[model samples]
Target: MRRLIAVALAVVLLVAGCTRNSDGAADVQVGGDPGASPTLRFRAPLTVTEPSSTVVWAGTGSALVEGKPVLIDYWLENAETGAVVAESYTTSPKPYLLTKESLGTDLFAALRGQRVGARIVEVSPASAARGMTFPTVIVMDVLATRAEGDPVPARPGMPIVTLAADGAPTITPTTTTPPTDLTVVPLIKGTGDQVPTGAEVTIQYTEVDWATGAVVDSTWSTGLPVSFSLAGLGAWSQGLVEQTVGSQVMVVVPPSFGLGGPAGSELQSATLVFVVDILAATKPTAPVSPPVTIAPSTAPSSSPTS
Candidate 1:
């Protein structure tokens, strides 16, 4: 996972014979189709005296908002040698919480006002504290973090779900009796890869109680998605195994399907409803242990147990 860039003060020294545009961006050429690896053309030994960012292409999608999750594909290269350092285009796009605390000042500024599908280039000077002797350039493509897919009509008896302007979901349970079996319904059908069992899944979810129609927990409140192995979350493991990325799903879990807690617990007999947005799913490279279970309280454990 990509982490926040470390910030440290360094003396800014101008490099001789380097050209910069009006925006302070390096005079480099960027060419590529959207959603593909960008081609960069620049003189070797390129250097920048200060950090600069330029949007190579503006997106036609929705504007990026702060305190929300953003997905991005990035390519980092050494501007001095034209050597590729790290990239996400060959792998999967990474997710980040769009906050200054999570993305650091420079990165946050670069992505702050941009919209989804925008491609941005950031140039940074060398910093000894960061172990960089040569300047680096990073190209980033912002992707939609929310579910974007074909809307699917939900089952008649399932709870009603509504979305806020920011894509946070609200669940309203009906007066109808809860189902006795585990039920999975896709509220939105995505075009991405299907999630396999035991895959590490990233999702934004809201959990509601069926009987009281009260919300028990939500990831939107925290402004970050959660990623975990779907091994022991009984209903989640069963229902989400074949779900695709960028999809939104509604799951009805009876107490027998788990997530209500151990026997004799307060919610052990309760029926649970979940509205989940599937962000990303990747198979683990190594064996993963089941996550620890927390003691049940007024709210159930975020990681449901078998």
Candidate 2:
């Protein structure tokens, strides 16, 4: 994950005017589709007295909410020489929380009220960072960072799932005895690519113990999504392999397929219920590496034997 721009600078709100001298960002010419790298045209040695942002195209998708994750593809260049400084189009878009601290003041202002699919252009004065002696220009494309799909009614006998306003899930375990075998259910069918084994996946999930209905872990509480190799999550790797991006899936894992904890721990022989939102997935071009070990809150120094 790439870090955002320097946070030491002050906030600069979007300037409102029609001429190049009044709003430098409006003077910039942006060309290209929404999701691709944009072609920027402006005179060399451009002078920007203050930071300004101009929306190149307004989006029709959902509005970006505060504290939620925002995905964006950006191209930053030196305005003076019209030289490229950094960009994300060559690789993948980066994710950031929609907060002043996470996106810096200028970026936060530029994307604050925008919706998914919007393209924006921002021009700012020089900063203290290396190679940033001259003013800079950035073009950004907003992308959805949460699951967006057609809701599918879950089959009977599955755990009851409810969603918060921001898309976090709450799983209510059934009163009946838990299933003894692994079960996979797709609660939201996505239109994105199907996940493959060993793919690097980014997800937000809540894991509960079926026997107690207690939420033992949740990515929602942390306020950020996590990405990892799908090689060592036991039933997760098996159940999510064929799932599609932008999907919300529920997986019930028996003790045999669950992440076994230390002896005498509640998770050692417990059934694990997981509600997962698959945000993104990319198949590996090289050999997959083993997943990092995640120690449970009640576990000892040793790693789980699963």
Candidate 3:
């Protein structure tokens, strides 16, 4: 298990993206929006090949566009063999969705400037840490894009404070949401290696954006005595939580929280790597039972010992 986690970490560090499957759709985590993915004025050397490569022209990509929202539909397949690995198709179909300004992630930056039904793109130089760079190929399809002022979808897992957009609360409505936060730490010495859900744990952590290698937040739990709820709940509330409490994990909280997007305008995903030690455990008290005493039979004193 530790080995698998270590490998996963290696993959994340090299790939520069986060992946999540939602309702048969994949949310490919990308870097911050820099102003509409750079218009591919020229082809990039460090890139991946997508199915749309042939149909598209050779041009440089755009950084996400500021203010304007980018709406798109994507499909991922092996570039070399056309084998489908992931796709984002909605049976109901909600057309024209923009990349929210408030959120941050890698996709925003990489996918900017790309218009809907425009064409697919490929990226190479398989990030330094992506050990298995030879994954055949990746294909993405762009359906359409919309300018800013378009209605943005309300993302989940964030608190919606009824305040003005401005921090003043009363003057300009603001929603006090948690900043994009995450930590990757190593457990201290003598700290049990396993991260059980019900055990108290400790570790040292550093945080980085899932979309970019930029450090936005970091926190440590050195020798700190803490208990577990086993579900990693109430933990993310405190900045750090183990999905399995012991297993190393990558936690991503995208933009939409008001925090500066990854690399400006790009969506943000906080990826965490945890090496926790069980320091203590919370358990119910055991019940106490009375002890019983035993008596031996007497033989009439044996007549004064003869």
The best candidate in terms of TM-score: 1
TM-score of each: 0.74, 0.74, 0.23
* Full candidate order by lDDT, most accurate first: 1, 2, 3
Q: What is the C-alpha lDDT of each candidate?
A: 0.71, 0.69, 0.27
Off by over 4 Å in 2: 1-49, 77-93, 129-135, 231-234, 258-260, 284-306
lDDT of 3 at 266: 43
Clashing pairs in 1: none
- After superposition, candidate 1 runs with Cα above 4 Å error: 1-46, 77-97, 128-134, 231-233, 284-301
Q: Model 2 clash tally?
A: 0
What lDDT tens digits, residue by residue, belong to model 2 across residues 96-162? 7888777777678878999988988777777665235677777778876667899998788778999
The prediction achieving the highest lDDT against the true structure is 1
Over all chains combined, what TM-score does candidate 3 have?
0.23
